[model samples]
Target: MAKINKRRKRIFNMLKSHPQGLNGEAISQQLGVSSRTIRSDIKALQDALGQYNIRIFSSPTKGYRFSQFEHLSSIEHELFKDNMSNLETSKQRINYILYKLLANTLNDISITQNDLAEEMYISLSTLKIHLNEVKNILKKYDLRVTQYKTKGIKISGEETKLRYCIVDIKNIHLENEFFQDLIMNIDTDLLDDIIKKVLSERKLQLTDRSQKKLCMYIAIAMQRSRNNKTVVYPSSLTNKIENTFEYNVAKEIIENIYNQLNVDLSCSEVYYITQCLLASKKLIDVSESINKKRVKNLVNIILKEIHEKLSIDFTNDEYLIDGLTLHLNIALTRIQFQMNIRNELLETIKNDYPLAFQMGVIAGKIVEQYDNIKINENEIGYIALHFGAALSRNGIKENIQAKNIIIVCSSGLGISVLLKAKVEEYFHNRLNVVKVLPGYEVNEKTLENIDYILSTVPLKNIASDKIIKINRMLQKEDVENIENKIFHKKDTDLMEITTFFN
Candidate 1:
């Protein structure tokens, strides 16, 4: 399994670099794996990348290119439904549970060894072994498990390290086929009600459209909870409500039950719960009646928990916070649209981290939009491809060196020294600095072959071509502006024109 994972990572990297994808035969040779194994690996990569709006395609001439990255922003708006179909196996469910458990424990500071054991219903020895294994897995990324008696057990590491651990664990768990089968069998309705209640108690509103969406999201979450991949949506509600208002209210109640009690209901399980919410929504406009303070508290709790537990800090940027609050209110407007609640938050995310967030949102949206679509990690590979492409297009340009120029300043010290430091900081990699020429020792040879001149003191009767004026004192902004001008210059020749005072 480790070997397979390594091969997958290598193949992913190779594909990312070679956007016009590599052939299976080439991949096999590169990884030293059999063609059969490469074929399977390709399929897995495709499924993983699907969520990111990346698709791998084979062609006679071009070989392969992740064709989706260019339009991932648009493509990710719709869910990839194809990937949803294969998630029904039993092994998939186990993997899902394992990942969720690990993610939850790693994120939560309140969770301890005993708490994990009890929650998992495993013996202490088994729990310890499992945690040890998890720790071993985390060690690869320089992340460590620190068991604190006061703070509880927590995974301590940098943000990037934590992300790697989470993504790896989730990927491995989702690859289980048995859990996928089990997920396919779980009832969606019961799961939906449970999710709705959780949202409502958290003060997140769902419109009619969102209510259904939330139900689906919950179904997915529940399926994930059970270590399964597929969720079964029910055809009809068991207890039908007379009025729409009443039904919406009842939906809230069912959602509440699921949130408070971990007893998730299948569509069959929460048929009545759906009816009640629908009826309540029709009869009473509970939107106005909801306590504002309570809602605020709920949102805070959810966001705080997600941040602390997941180590996924959705930084409280002003725009992001405002956007989340706006979306939360919009979701509360109608219980039916509750599931669509996160859409606005996602939109806000796009605004903040235009590249990465947009990519993630688009990938998620594509999966939500399409049913039965299988996307894999190759989609992320494609995003990386596009990112690289963008960088290549817009990043720094190299200049052809006319002559190697060396800079000299007074005494290698003092305010003239500070000027030297600024010049070095700005042009260290781009230009070569030889030695500092003090005022008394300065000679014509020092200026002899120098292509350009930078000086704090005025030089008399020196080579006219070698003289350029520089400020005696350099400011912070001066350094920044100079670097920016050099790095972003459209004309390459201007790169060598180092006029310090200007």
Candidate 2:
């Protein structure tokens, strides 16, 4: 039986003997446990009983009562009986408290190691041991829980990386229950109001996106600050605005207003401009920067290079150009941030664009420089953008229609899905996948008109003129091979080379 069930049974027994019911203090005294422990036990019992028609209620003067005990099923009784032994051990309780302390300290800026030990009611040596364990857990996700003599232990990593790391940790340790309880106790609606007031005081109107990003940044910054390391500043606010708005018109509006008001366009200055742009009733041309002629020319050059070098056709479209440009800027920003270099965007583009994988390769290089950091191929949006930017600058014009490919696999659904994910990761917006057909379901008729064929199993009937065999598990070399095969066909169209940017 679980420990909680045993405690609940004991409480029910006590109430039955008392007739009027036992108050919290009486139960705690009788059970030889702290009031807090008893309360927690009561909550656990309530949760357990709630699954059935059984109900436990509390009266301010009379204390907790089993109001509908008769309605409980034999199965419920058995289940509750089984849960008696699951009550947390004293050591587990200590660990829980220690985890909470670490989480809170990670969200504070000025707390020191000594301060943390005091707050957690533990000796410095004991605190250090607990912190070391937390740090080891954090290291698996390429994050570190660092401590300084002047500051307490705190988590540090890239924002998105750290967010995912936290998600992992929460899943592993089942810490969501504790967080849920903590959040439940707070007035979140009131907190939102308070945040709005705070932003208003700073003369900033926090848009939904800014509010969310700022919150995340502040949380992570505080975590890093607790380790006595200077937190990295967010990317230049202008870049964020441009990426979010994706138009110069919004920027122009702000620039004109600032000129009239004589307000210097500082990082903080853009916040209000973003708010105004979002509030505007007028719908300006968001795609005005996307030049169709320029995009067509760039697409043609890329297609030509693919035909001569690797033999693949990417139907160049306006969407691809916009997507690629956005990705490129983000990649450049990430590289600059990693290198701790400010205002070196042009240098990053000039030096890295010639590489085969473009921004993806560059991002991998940056990740290699950081200790224990790993960049998965799935996170290579910036690489796609770099390719787009390169094409734009070279001004090679081509018109190619986008094509769809269906993969066939006999290695089962799981492996087929993995390969599909890898293909999507590498190709980004370049490839359109119609579906993954199992080898048994594949027919020559179905495969005849497919743009490309990727298969884990040997083709029984070759119908498609273009077919590429890939392993069930995709590797880096495999991605390169696939790229080479797709771009090396002779009949693919080539375009006259021109500068990407005019």
Candidate 3:
């Protein structure tokens, strides 16, 4: 009778009461729609509120909530001010199916194809397209969807593989309130207490995100173990990690889980948790024992490769070298254990730092040659950040004149240096490269001395007209773009004028 969808009104009411927020799953369960549909409804609601002075804020781990709505009574009045639409985009439907399948996998449930399609309110043809995508994603974790004639589909893989899928699925919806709630229901209070004590005693500090992730993984491990699905590490690997301080901390945490949650952990479970801790950060003692010669040699090799490929010299960048070495130590541990770290700004980096991303790709090959572990895009993205910073530091000089410009390359040094060389060669005294930065590092403060921002990536939300996006490798089109911006003239006429003068 209200004309508002029951789900939309219900979600609004829930968020109104729970200021903290709720994940998609929590809203879906109450509304009887897929989490995918809930996500779409939230987006629609947010768009509808554009006329009002209200906003919806989402947390990477906490779902969504209303912002700028101080009066509680005002929310219900505005619940459906605009006509609510129920259009589910193809992408949203795919995400919904992924969520549903992963949820079913975690709970060891099976679903028929017909039932899945019916639940998602889609046709069999559309459902298959989404399922194919899900299958591809699952393949990355070495899991597969097997179907029986009578029984719909179930995820099949090793216990470890299944758990990794679960972890990945958790990461995919990091901002889901339902997932956060699930993590909270697993005796997190006691787990956090034990973690704080262990980390404090070890003098290790983790950022808030890192701390949340560490706790979540521990909780996940406990849950899986309670389900008799503990990860089994190789004997040699277990023996190696069992001697470390992290292992001791993990063992203590597991013991506490037993005492508080009544879940007993096998040795393998302890070992698996240790790998999670080691993969997250480097322990002081562990850092001290890292193969200095090997790390130094690897750094030198990477630097040399970067220089050869891009003509960007980072040999003198002590900060870059030190940061990279430290990162490598932690990265190797994560790689060894097949743990993946999220690069939250990866899209921004890729879009803003094409040159740097290329440098990362080349550098990744060099690391694989030396370190023997294949590097994924996420890890390479981090590598690009270091190079981007180093490129900026190496190029920026305060004495450069008013024509000074900073190049932003999200990928790293190779593109920055190449672009700077091209600009100097072509523009001569017209423009100068005072700095080259990654997108994430370029801020208002960094732009103080800058006349123009030449970037391979877009600088979103920046009001400055000085920002220019260029090709990763300077092309004729890119040169023309620079000419148009800097000279305010056609390149052909400008070149003719310079040619006549020469």
RMSD in order of candidates: 26.0, 16.8, 14.2
Model 1, position 219, has a per-residue lDDT of 39
Reference-based lDDT, each prediction: 0.44, 0.48, 0.69
Predict model 2's lDDT versus the native: 0.48
Which sections of candidate 2 miss by over 4 Å? Answer: 1-102, 106-137, 140-142, 146-175, 181-309, 315-322, 330-375, 381-502
Measured against the true structure, the TM-scores of the candidates, in listed sequence, are: 0.21, 0.33, 0.58
- Put down candidate 2 lDDT per residue, 1-502, tens digits, no spaces: 1234456667756755665557999899988889897787777667766666566678889887776555443545564443323324544434543345435544454446665554443468876776676566667656766554565555556544454344334434554354333222223343334434444443333324334333333333323333542323355744554554323433443354345433234433243333333322111113222334543454445545554554433445454444443332333333332311112123433354444345345545444443235544433433433343334323333223535778765432223434565576666655666777655345677766767877766776665556778875566766766666776522232232333434
lDDT at 488, model 1: 51
State the TM-score for model 1: 0.21
Write down the RMSD of candidate 2 (Cα, Å): 16.8
Q: Model 1 residue 43 lDDT?
A: 76
Q: Write one digit per residue (lDDT tens) for candidate 1, span 168-270.
A: 4433445554324433554566655565545445443433433543344333344444543222334432222223333454455445646654645444324
lDDT of 3 by residue, 1-502 (tens): 2234445666777988878877777888887789787787787667656666578898868888888758557655665543223326776666666666666655678889887775555679988998899899889888898985687898788876676666767766777533443343477777877776677666654433455567777787777666676776777877678666677778887777777778777878888877778766332224332466687778888888889878877887776777677767667666876776666657766987777788788878988987788998888877776666565455444333448888776432333444565666566567867755555445677667777888877776676778888876577888888888877878767788898785
* Model 3 alpha-carbon miss at residue 172, Å: 3.6
Candidate whose TM-score is highest: 3
